[model samples]
Target: MVMETIEKVIVNLGASDIDSRLEELLIDGILYAFQEQIMNDDANVMLNEFGIVVNALGQRVKPYLPHICGTIK
Candidate 1:
């Protein structure tokens, strides 16, 4: 699902536009992945690391993300 969505976006926007859209798409993908993971009992422990990484990456991407995207989720 993530790959297909990204492919569609790239097809529409072109590779050159990746610098702007990459973070947006990546965050969207991560959120979906997290949602799936949370549905499993074993995923709770693993998601700790995942959450940390997402938080750090989100801070770095804050500058380029859309104004609303920068808001706390």
Candidate 2:
């Protein structure tokens, strides 16, 4: 529920409007969630949300690509 809400918020805010610091924090939190909850069913939902957030982030996601891809792997 929370991740869905966050995804919506990020999507509504769009990429340029999001602050870099907040982007870092969101990426960190999502990565941490991926690391800690990969075995759970909720992880699937989180992964979906993560993709939406990544798209919402646009070019801002570049720096975190490797980390995100590694976490997904």
lDDT (Cα, 0-100) at 66 in candidate 1: 64
Q: For model 1, what is the alpha-carbon lDDT of residue 65?
A: 53
Q: Candidate 2 regions off by >4 Å?
A: none
Q: How far is candidate 1 from the true structure (C-alpha RMSD, Å)?
A: 8.2
- Scanning candidate 1 in windows of ten residues, the lowest lDDT window is 64-73
Q: Identify the candidate with maximal lDDT.
A: 2
Per-candidate TM-score against the hidden true structure: 0.37, 0.83
Q: Give the TM-score comparing model 2 with the true structure, all chains together.
A: 0.83
- The digit string of per-residue lDDT tens for model 2 on 1-73 reads 6688888787776667768898899899888877877457888898899999988887889999998998888
- What RMSD, rounded to one decimal, does every model reach? 8.2, 1.7
lDDT of 1 by residue, 1-73 (tens): 4444554554565444344466677666655565555346635543454444444454555653563343323
Model 1 residue 22 CA deviation in Å: 1.0
